[model samples]
Target chain A: MNTWEIRFAMGNEAIAEGALAAGARFYAGYPITPSSEIAEIASRRLPQVGGVFIQMEDEIASIAAIIGASAAGKKSFTATSGPGVSLMQENLGVAVMSEIPCVIIDVQRSGPSTGLATKPAQGDVMQARWGTHGDHGIIALAPSSVQECYDLTIKAFDFSEKYRTPVYLMADEVIGHMREPYVLHEAAGLVSRKQPDPSEPGGDYKIFDFERYDDHIAPMPPYGGKYIFRMNGSMHDEAGFGCGASDNADKFIRHYEDKITKNRDDIVMTESYNMEDADYVLVSFGCSARSAMAAMRLARQEGEKVGVLKLMTLWPFPDKEVAAALKKAKAAVVPEMNLGQVASEVSRYNERKIPVIGVNRVDGSMITPYQILDALKGLYLKGLSLKGL
Target chain B: MKQRWEIIFSGVGGQGLLLSGNLLGAAVSVIEKRQAVMTCTYGTETRGTFTKSDVILSDGYIDFPEVLDADVVVSLAQIAYDRYVDVLKPKTLFLYNSNQVKEAPSPARQVGLPMEEMAAQAGAPAAVNIVALGILTALTKCVQPTSIQEMLTRHFKGRQDVLGANIKAFEAGLEEAGK
Candidate 1:
């Protein structure tokens, strides 16, 4: 018997529902435009499911609260906008260094600093990658549609649990505010944090046991569990005590980076549309991918062989898939709300030396299909000129 | 049936433009089992400012949510009519509230209706947006009137008086378009 239900919902509502479906038990957040709906829904629905919801004084407190909740063995998450995300950066680092499992939903708005409170922008792509001022690896997922907003939020929780790290659901105002139809399905393949074995010896429980675990990820027991261990924000030894040794610092730092980099295959996801035997490629993520898809369809109608490579996983960047697409295409177009954030990444993988164009919009409006098609037409004209020579 | 239909409902804030768009979207997406995307743009203030909702109904996947080429455009305010009149294509069906906007020279096919007057006549002056929606339903036939009626019944479930007035307003709109 199928248990799916179809409903018309906004993207922000989908994210909140997705969290509930993924077994998120606690939510702490401050209201912000484009993302306030998530917090609103969570505040009302979390309690109905016997979960907890708290409206923090600010974004800093919000992140700190969720970190505290997750440390106590709850699947916790928070939602906010770009400015709020900027405020949460310090606490975000604490989650990273302490290796606490949590999810942060950043519904991006136009900004260098609250540039446009209610408008959508993809300016936070680089920020999500290196926002917290650390060399640590991060996992960020972009959702272009309401359905993805639902599906990827659950994936974010699963990744946070499996890897014991904070994951980002990088949404934009377009997806957050826009309403569309989506099906709610029973979540399968849910991952929870590995807990320390209760039957084993209780004393001297090394919280960061790299040597015992081949994957380098140690089981994280709750605060009130049998194993009492420390969670240090500073560089620490395997036993979680503050260690100032140079080599100890190196090992733990490398452990943090290697855990994600070594497991890239399991973490990264990308979608290919009309990419089979295409000469032109469009690389985009977040809301911009929708425009790319529309442009690809229009170009196809005009008999232009254009394809789209949508980045579902933003961080631990899909290097292999991007490099492969860039190598095959005659030319590439990177459309984004920001000016060339993801385009720079696409160009880095441009080993084929083909022309990589950037279609950008920051006027608080979406990058329309016509704008992207214009870029493709320019590339087509350039290709014709080269062929004539 | 048309493979795709892109419609825009534009007016000042508090005119129930977003509600009209939502009703149409829910009708097609949920009742008809088709795909629909509704995106609304408004200012920080809740009322007396320009507001527009773009609804795109498609038989296949909708890549871009905004209207690239509008099949039908409904304007209930002069600012909205002025904003979109020049951008419309010749084949586009442009609907306007004659009570608020003066007839403008345009290439697109134009249909003018007194939505405010129709709503008052329907005994629901606040439901001008529903009257406009009714006219849209009659002209486009994108979704069945019964589908929209089902949505209205669901939307105004508790308020019987409002529901009756809105149903009468919607019928008034459908009747005006038919004539």
Candidate 2:
């Protein structure tokens, strides 16, 4: 619990320190590029804190081991790149359905089967939601700065523990490898899921309460605890028993969706810069937001009414906040490291019929502020021509 | 908002530009209590390919960490100079090593200084990056000269010779740039 310490560190180092600060007692992960630093740091530091660290044979085994550790009542996590995350998909799907508490780090690189290992791409934005296959709820946080890399890792763990689900920290290589001066704060407030009371009457213990699942998370009992139950991945009843009732299956999926979406007010967060009286709104996440901020500042200085909406939380898409920020703007320009993964989402979620333009760059080179300004300049002409200003 | 100092160090892999960027960032943010962000990106090349590091030194918080256009671009080799010459603004100060680079076809307002020769005279030819930092500090006055000296001493703690030679090279560069 070191506090008020200032040091120069990489983005990945900050994330590892953040996770350790959040009381993560177990780390089981395989090595991958741009993200191996998280595992390497955890290996050296976890033992000092009396935590367990293991390097499994492959990505699949690494995820499986963490899930088992979490079942045994340990705050666990694993770090991987695209290829490793792709390999951990099936187990990740299982974790999603079973509502296991774990944090997964996808330090994204160029993808589609062993692509550029060291180069960065935000190409996994869509994959983070749908990659696990079935219909389930997931919370993903995107950090743009080195400080947020630390802060958001704590947030990722908090959401996973509070909601009893797997969370993803979707960071690219630029944000993962970039170094800066960060003042380390006190340990974050750790959140652990509610466990069933061991002393409760045997007849009163219902581990998975179905109707209350919307507002109340089910109390999970550790494997060696007094309560006995099955941790099944398939469709199950309130007591964790196998069930073939069609109505019960209908209730299972609905509760999962409502539990997260009904609470999306707290789960989704966004950052808005100079949104008042803006003509063009720049929407971005992760490293792309940094360049967008710079471009927005430049446009303001030149007397152009441009603003930026940085999506700190990528999943559960902050629709209301985005619409509010762009209430006065004429259009939005989405700049992503990938080819408009979030841009497409913005266009779909845009309720005001505000034209959404996407500025995409995927060559492992960053989309500079100059590029964002170019997109806004094009939009400025369209706005002027329509209004005859 | 006042513009922050945007600086770029460009060279081949072995010239220690990345460490130079780190030293500058540490000097400003750690000792001087100003905000700074230093970034570096490299390909698979070890010695010959283009490698660059950027340092954004600001008085307040930094929103953007990357520098697309730089106020100063230091070129340690001929290829780096040629690669960056076309991108320089008329106001940019393009600094090049006189011994390593020969020609600048465009009018880039460059000052060809013998940074390598200055390092050689300071008893450590490997300290060219520090010398370049010294020149930048002396010319721009973005940071105090003593702060960079303190950072260099802390960065090379165990090797006394490395520390002393880099200090001498940095002083020589500062003196030359002042003249």
Candidate number of the best TM-score: 1
Which pairs clash in model 2?
none
For model 1, the stretches where C-alpha displacement exceeds 4 angstroms are: A384-389
Candidate 1 local accuracy as lDDT? 0.91
Q: What TM-score does chain A of each model score against the native chain A?
A: 0.97, 0.95
List-wise, what DockQ does each model earn? Answer: 0.83, 0.61
Q: Give Cα distance to truth, residue B86, candidate 1, Å.
A: 2.7
Give me the displacement of residue B84 in model 2, in angstroms.
1.2
Q: After superposition, how far is residue A303 of candidate 1 from its true place, in Å?
A: 1.5
Candidate 2 CAPRI grade:
medium
How many steric clashes between backbone atoms does each model show?
A: 0, 0
Error of 1 at A141 (Å): 0.2
Q: Pick out the ten consecutive residues of candidate 2 chain A with the lowest summed lDDT.
A: A380-389
lDDT by residue (A1-389, candidate 2, tens digit) is 56677767788999898888888989999989889999999999899999999999999999999998887888899999999998999998878767788999999888778788878889988888888877777789999988889989998889888887889999999899888887678764578778765567544345667465545788877766667656777888877788889998888777676667777898998987888777888999988998898888888788787888899898878878877866677788999988888988887767778878899988887888989888877776775422211
lDDT of 1 by residue, B66-173 (tens): 987899999999999998888799989999999999888988899999999999999999999999999999999998999999999999999999999999999999
Stretches > 4 Å off in candidate 2 = A201-207, A210-214, A383-389, B1-3, B113-125, B157-169, B175-179
